[model samples]
Target: MLLSDFIREGRKALLALYPAPEAGNLMTRLFSARLGLPPHTPLVHPETEIPPASLDLLQDDLDRLLHGEPLQYVLGAATFCGRDFKVSPAVLIPRPETELLVERALAAIDGAGPGCRVLDLCTGSGCIAWTLMLERPGLCVTAVDLSGEALAEARSQFPDRPAPHFVRADVLTQPRIDGGPFHLIVSNPPYVLERQKAQMRRNVLDYEPEMALFVPDGNPLLFYRAIAGMALTQLLPGGTGIVEINDALGPDTADIFIQAGFSDVSLLPDLSGRDRFIQFQRPF
Candidate 1:
């Protein structure tokens, strides 16, 4: 089948789930990944034919997308900080907003000296952990996650030896890191309240791991509380902590750090002006 024909049909099928522009974009990315052609290739080379073997693969992936699987999971990878990281049903796909957390953390780290210790709580897909480590080469990062499948995927994000150290630990339980004082702590932990699920789409609820996404409706800030409490002793004096937070609970989430006695507790907004991150520093 011609690439143009496949994209036309794929976008039509996806239109029922996503908007026209988004559906078109998804089809473009799908074609790019599956065929190694640029998104605009089909527009230019409308008659380009796809071989029978490739068509079978595309059909399988298209069916999965139609059934509510996220494109990242279907593609088996996600790009974060310009690096493509492996992803699966085992982990949550990295979102563009989470990049804000990384940016803030990196900015905070600029003043800190080399060889600083970093801890990443609820490190699904290791996107934040690996980004920090790669962006700041000398920082030692220890990342923890409760899901073994997620830990496995996180470990696979980069080179084994030079990569962030991945650990299996429940963030709710205050898992101990042998290294006492981390210079920075970062996370993009579960913040979605069960009640908020209604506002979300079926693709996220069905494809992503529930444990990595949702919290009890009664306590939407559960992970934030846990990470803040853990930071009390684990963060080095003058160390910084940053986390991705639900826009709806920005002030409440900042209160966790404030009440915990961290200095400079503040809520940062994303591009849309939603309160998306909480940043604080351990007292000097």
Candidate 2:
């Protein structure tokens, strides 16, 4: 079958779940990433035939997409902080907004002493951890996650780079993780309230790891409170901690760190201008 015909049908099939533009983009990404064809392949070579083997693979991926599996999980990777990181059902797919946490983290660590340390809590796919270690050389990073499967997925990313020491531990349990006194502590931990799940798409609800994406609605700040408690002892004096937060609880999330004895607690916004992150510092 011709690539153009495949793209037309794929976009139509995906329209049930995604808008036309997004569906088209997904199709473009699928062809480019999976088949190594250019994004404009359908436009430039409309008659290009998809081989039987490649067509079968595309059909399998399409089936998964139609069934509410995220494209990232189907593709087995997600891009975060300008790097593609391995992802699976065991981990949450990285989001673009989480890049803001990494940006702020890099800023906080600027001009730090050699071998600066970072702690990443609930490090699902290790996107933030790997991005920091790669974007800034000579840094020591330790990442923690509860699920062995999630830890395995995080550990498998970027083997050639200086690896963060991935630990299997619950973020809610404050005393377990060591190798801290870190210059920076960052997390994109589970902040989505259970009630908010209704507002989300089926692809995320069904495919992403539930442990990595949600908290009980009655205790919406569960992970933030735990993160704040852990940061109190783990972060060094004057060190920074940042996290991606649910937009609906921006001020409340910031107050968690402030009430935990952290200083300079700040609620920040994402590109959409919704409060999406909180940053705080350990007093010197």
Candidate 3:
């Protein structure tokens, strides 16, 4: 079977679940991942024949997509901060927006002395933690997650490089981390309200881990409150704390840090200009 024909048929099949452009993109991604070809190959080499041995595998991947499984989970990888990180149902697939959280955290710690301590709470897939350690190389990072499975996934990334110390502890309940007095504290913890679940698509709602994605609607700022309290004690004087937040709750979330006595509390926007993150600093 030709690559182009596969893409055409796959896209048509996926259209039942996705819009035209997205369906086409999913087909392209499946083709690229399975065949080890560039995404553009299907278009450029329309007549290229797919190996008979590989045809069944490609179809199986497409079937997963049709069943509303996220392509990242099917492939066992998700690209974050320009590197592909391992992902599974055990951890949330890293999102592009969270890259901004890492950028701001790095900027906040720039010019710091070597071995600057950093803490990452609810560190799913360890994307932010690993990226910081890899990009700066001098910082000491400790990351925490509640799920043993999630912690294992985080620890498994970038085997050749040193990983942040991963601890299994419920972020909302843990009072203090052992490695603290950190220069920076960061998290992309659960902020999605349970009520908002209906607004989400099946790919996310059905496939992503609920523990990493939701909170009680009655108290949606639960994780923020806990992180704020942790920062007050764990952060070094004049240290910074940053986190990704649900867009609709920006001001509300910022207030959590402010009321916790963090100075320099600021609500930051993502590239789309939505209130997507909150940053705060411990007073000197």
Please give the CA lDDT of all the candidate structures: 0.89, 0.88, 0.93
RMSD of each: 1.3, 1.2, 0.8
TM-scores for every predicted model: 0.97, 0.97, 0.98
lDDT score for candidate 2 against the true structure: 0.88
TM-score of 3: 0.98
Q: List, in order, the clash count of every candidate structure.
A: 0, 0, 0
Model 2 per-residue lDDT tens digits across residues 79-191: 88778899989988898988888999999999887689999998889989889889888899999988999998889898787799999887786564778788899998888
Highest lDDT scorer? 3
Task: Give me the overall lDDT of model 3.
Answer: 0.93
lDDT of each residue in 3-77, candidate 1, tens digit only: 889999999999989999998988889889988997789878888998888999999989988987889999999
> Where is the poorest 10-residue window by lDDT in model 3?
39-48
Task: Kindly report which residue stretches of model 3 are placed more than 4 angstroms away from their true locations once superposed.
Answer: none
Q: Can you rank all candidates by lDDT, best first?
A: 3, 1, 2
lDDT of 3 by residue, 159-187 (tens): 99988999999888987998879999999
